[model samples]
Target: MQHLRVAWALAGAAAGFFLLFLIQAHLFGEGQLVAGTCEIVTLDRDSSQPRRTIARQTARCACRKGQIAGTTRASPACVDAQIVRSRQWCEMMPCLDDEGCDLLVNRTGWTCAQPGGRVKTTTVS
Candidate 1:
């Protein structure tokens, strides 16, 4: 029957749409796919920081400490309460073997990169 085939096609299309909606909901949480009216904002990142790992946050302190890489839905955290209170500077030579470190003016600097990279060093006043 011609009408029977049309009904079967319509049923398949409905099932496909339902599955798609369910997948989107599972990936982005419920009601996130609703049009407009979302609370998202960009964060303040250091100008010198790499652009490869930058993200926005929906709320304050939504990410873990020292997370420089994240998605648009989540924000990255840099430094926790304990670390900020202690005022402890991160160690130098964070690179593994085959990587070079830039000591610059201070023995404990935070600039490290691959070998043969341009580095800056100036004497303290």
Candidate 2:
């Protein structure tokens, strides 16, 4: 009957909407995902001696669904997926075998310096 078909369609629509809502809630909910801890080592430059001391540090970070844990200059925190994929400082192997990649000072980009003194820079948002 026409009424029976209409009821089934309405039920199917409602189920689809519910499924969508559940998926959104699972991804965007308040609960955060732990990306894990990271250990960092650096040179301590403030010392008066000519030789720098090695400074060791650890950081525990939590990131959202699309992010991963990373260390910024100031602290440990979440980093965007695109930045990780881009693999700054030659991690992505963007340059030729003989060339080198250097992370820019601003931390928003990188430069591939060639043997001929040519520099190619790419910026990420």
Candidate 3:
């Protein structure tokens, strides 16, 4: 009977440890799994803004056959392709004196210095 009790206790402890391990794996392992590159082909359009957010900026990677990763904005006649490998935004800047600029997959905020003591904010989408 004593042997049975010890065996049961050991089994319960093992099960508990396995459950904790699974929980930790689920929380931390999933995020690490999603890191990789994304290859995309940009569609040509006459409009200044690209169709998608990823289409607006150049990705960071080696260009092959006239296709590069860093062609973020393309001309209406230029059909650009890129691969965005990283999840973080490529660039970030201030929109204005008081506004904060953040560049994301779909939106890019720009702050340009004017001739005078003024700054211009431009949002590229």
Q: Clash totals for all models, in order? A: 0, 0, 7
* Residue 61, candidate 2: alpha-carbon lDDT: 61
Per-residue alpha-carbon lDDT of candidate 3 for residues 1-125, written as tens digits (9 for 90 to 100): 99999999999999999999999998887424222223444443345555423224323343345432332322111123332223222232223344433344354544445456454334443
The local distance difference test score of model 2 is 0.61
lDDT, residue 66, model 2:
78
Error of 1 at 19 (Å): 1.3
Q: Any runs in candidate 1 off by more than 4 Å, and if so which? A: 31-65, 68-125
lDDT of 2 by residue, 1-125 (tens): 99999999999999999999999998987544445433333433245545433234444466667766554433455666676776563454545666677888876766668898877665554
How high is the lDDT of residue 106 in model 3? 52
Candidate that would win on lDDT:
2
lDDT of 1 by residue, 1-125 (tens): 99999999999999999999999889999445233123344554334665343233342333344432211211123333443333222321234455554444443323335467643221111
User: What TM-score, computed on C-alpha atoms, does each candidate reach?
Assistant: 0.30, 0.31, 0.30
Better of 2 and 3 by TM-score: 2
> What TM-score does model 2 achieve against the real structure?
0.31
Better of 1 and 3 by lDDT: 3
In candidate 2, stretches whose alpha carbon ends up further than 4 angstroms from where it belongs are 1-89
